[model samples]
Target: MKGKILELLKKNKGDFVSGQKISEELNVSRTAIWKYMNQLKDEGYEIESVSRKGYRLILTPDVLTYDEIKDLLKTKRIGRDILYFNSIDSTNSKAKQLASDGKGEGTVIISEEQTKGRGRLGRNWVSPKGKGVWMSIIIRPDIQPIDASKITQVTAAAVSKSILELGIKNYIKWPNDIIINNKKVCGILTEMSGELNKINYIVIGIGINVNLDENEIPNDIKDIATSLKIESGKKVSRKQLVANIFNNFEELYEELLNKNEITHSIEICKENSAVLGKEIRVIFRNKEIRGKAVDLTDEGELLIENQEGKIQKIISGEVSIRGVNGYV
Candidate 1:
């Protein structure tokens, strides 16, 4: 009922909609509409109520509630069922639990803040209260466990394209991280629970620094992390960003699932790659190899050329671009 009221107000945004009209449209009492309007105001929505002009939606808060994002969403299934939380230990952990309980695919677990947020390599991800995007998605694909890593690439492409849609220049730091201005603004962690031949479910955790200011960023990662607000010089709408991500993700994921090919996603990754044609250091299993990132394979693997002119295909590793960020 409240969502319907919000929808009416949003449709007539910046204009007045009479209480009587709303009551007739939604079949609710005028007194109930008044109460709902008050509730929306308490939830941080700025609505103007005139003596005879009724209500006008002045501003929408930067919130991630389902009511806030439902209207913004344009995807078929990626975010249709969202489990939102004010604060949680971790969206990934909660999503994994739900998936183990036989939750359907495309169920999203999102939180305004994650008390125990973590990134790739188990590094602590700073998810300040109402400051960033901390969410996880549960998926049940029929592919083998070995093919699970491709989901990371697909997510990277989706995130890269979504951020690009916001007029922000960003790049995909192969396998999972999204970089802006040589600093990381987002990270993806893909975890799967299944046997060698059969797969049960996969949880893809995505953390993005959206509206955090300088003070909100931890001191340890200030040099290597940034937020969209810090880069764009404006506050970004988290709901819109979330919708864009789901829309792009659904498109790319459908391609991967239905057609069994991610050529479009691969093209997006290649076009926005941060390490292609650059000298890099690949660290895996306590071994470091120096190579030049030459190309990305059709299967989304990194192709590296060693100093000896030998090409090697890298599936997963910590790739650090030499001379950038002092990582070498």
Candidate 2:
């Protein structure tokens, strides 16, 4: 109801909308309209309410409000049902709970800040208030569990493509990281719950350093992590970035499902690849293998030739790939 009222007020921007007219249009009583208007004001919407003139939306806050995002959404399924939070433990945790509760595919859980945010390998991710994009997408693809790893690559491709569209030339560090100017700007973590033959659900958690200042980053990771604000020297609209990601992700995901392959996504990763053709060190359990990243196989595996000159295809392991020369 509040969303509807807000929409109406926004549509009638720069002009006063009478309470009686609002009540008539929404089939609500005048008192209900007044209550909704009050709620909007509390949410930081500068609404002017003159006794006879009704309500006029003077300004809207730059928050990632549901109504604001939904108004700009262009996807068919992804983000159709968005669960937004001002603060949370983690978007992935909330998304997993929603998936268990039978939330449909493409349902997104986004938070302004994550108190217990995490990255791949259970490493802590610093997610301060309004500093970056912390969100997870729940998907129920009909692919086998063996193919689940592909989703991570798909997410990397989607995010990298979105960054490129924003005029930043970025590259993909095989598996989950997106690098810009040798610094990591984005990370993706893909988690799933399913059987060997069927995937019940997969949650793709994406964290992008968007508007954080250099001082906001932790001292330990200050040298390796960067934000779009720092790189582009401007503030970015999280709402627009989120909407663009959903649009790009939905397009690629639908293509994968319909054709049983993600050729386009794979091609994007290869083209913007930071690991391919670079010397790398693959850190697995108890051992580190130095190799040169040759290419990404059709199945999205990293093909690397070890020091012994034997090319190996990596599907899954404790494999933490790092550029031998620098952090890519």
Candidate 3:
């Protein structure tokens, strides 16, 4: 009821919207509509009340309120059941516990600050209060465990598309890093819990450095990772960016769910990739393979061109990527 009323008010956009008309349209009593309007006012929605003209929505808070986000949502209900918190240890870790209690698919766990955030390769993710986006999605896709790499690729595609839609000239650096001007602005860490033969659930942790200033970044990482503010030369609203991501993610994920569209998605991913046909090196735990990044295959393996000019398909490991100049 609140969402419907809120939408009507927002659509009306501060013109006169009569309470009687809203009640008739929603088939509820005028008193109930008035109650809803008052409730919205209490929640920081600036609603002006006149004698008989009902109410007018004057302003909306910048916070990522459930109603505000849903109002802009045009996709399916992917982030419908959001578990938003002010602080947490990790969204992925929490989602795992939630899944154990039989939580349904598409349940999102988000936090304004993750005190003990993590990123790919167990690196500490810097999630300060109201500075970045720290969130995870709990999903239960009926797919084989061996095909799990596709999920990371799916996230990569969705992120790249979303970032580009924001009018940012960013592209992908394979496995999972959103690069802008050759610096990482976002990273993903995917974790799953289930048996090999039968799967249970998956949690994908996504962190985007949005509003951090250069001074906020640690000296060691100042040159490596960047935020939207640094790239765009001004502050970007976190609520707006997050809402766009969720909106695009819901539709793309549904397409993947219905048709298992990994093949086509992967093809598009390689096209926008930054490492293709370039000389590169993969540093694993034991050894480092220096070669040209010939191509990325359907199986999500990096085909490398060795110094001897031999083709080597290397499955992604707990390693690092580097351009011929230096570590990337």
Candidate 4:
């Protein structure tokens, strides 16, 4: 009911709709409409109420609620069904649980803050309240479990394109990380539950440092971590970025599902690659191999030419660029 009222007011933005008209259209009493309007105001919406003319939506708060982002979204599937949260243990955890319960594809789980946020390899991710994009997407792709790593590349491409569209220069660091000004801005973690021949579900978790300031970043990672606001010198619209990611992701993912290929996504990753043509250290298991990142395979594997003049296809590993951001 509140969402309907908000939609009506947003549709008639810059103009007033009579309370009586709203009551008739929504089949709710005028008193109920008044109550909802008060609730909107309390939620940081600047609504103007006139004596004869009714309510006018003046401004909307910077929030990532379903009602806030629904109108901003342009995707057909990726974010059509969103589970929004003010606080959660982890969006990825929730998404995995929901997917195991037979949730369909393209369901998004978003949260304002993650109490137990994590990154790859069980590393803790700092997710301050209202500071970043902490979301996970549940997808059921008809592909083998071996190809699940490609989803991380797809998501990295989508995120790179979306952030570039916002006029911020960024680069994809191999399979998952998005770098801005040579610092980490976004990270993608793809988790899958499936058999050898089939994939039951894949949860793509994305955590972006969107609005955090220098002081907000943890001191341990402050030198290597940054936010979109820090790089862009202005506040970024989290809702718009979320919508853009979904829009780009849906387009790229459909191509993969329908054609069983990720040529376009791989191209994007290559074009905006941070490690390509640079020396890198591939840390796999307990050993580290130094090589020059030369290219990305069609299946999204990292191609590195070792010093011994042999090229190795790296499926998954922690890659540290030799000279970038002191990552080595």
Query: lDDT of each prediction vs. the true structure?
Result: 0.91, 0.86, 0.78, 0.92
Q: For residues 97-190, could you state the per-residue lDDT of candidate 2 as single tens digits?
A: 9999999999999888999999988988999987789999999999999999888878888899888778878988888899777778998989
Error of 1 at 83 (Å): 1.7
* Candidate 4 residue lDDT tens string, 24-118: 99999988999999988876799999989899999988777778887777788899888988789999999999999998899999998999999
Report how far residue 107 has shifted in candidate 2, in Å. 0.6
lDDT of 1 by residue, 37-76 (tens): 9988977899999988899999998878778887778888
- Write down the TM-score for model 4: 0.94
RMSD of 2: 2.1
- Enumerate residue pairs that collide in model 1: none
Clashes of each: 0, 0, 0, 0
Cα RMSD, each candidate: 2.4, 2.1, 3.6, 1.9
Off by over 4 Å in 2: 316-328
Worst ten in a row by lDDT for model 2? 318-327
Candidate 3 per-residue lDDT, tens place, 70-125, comes to 65667666677888777899988898899888898878888888988998777899
Q: In model 3, what lDDT does residue 144 have?
A: 80
Total backbone clashes of candidate 4, pairs 3 or more residues apart or in separate chains: 0
**Candidate ranking (TM-score, best to worst):** 4, 2, 1, 3
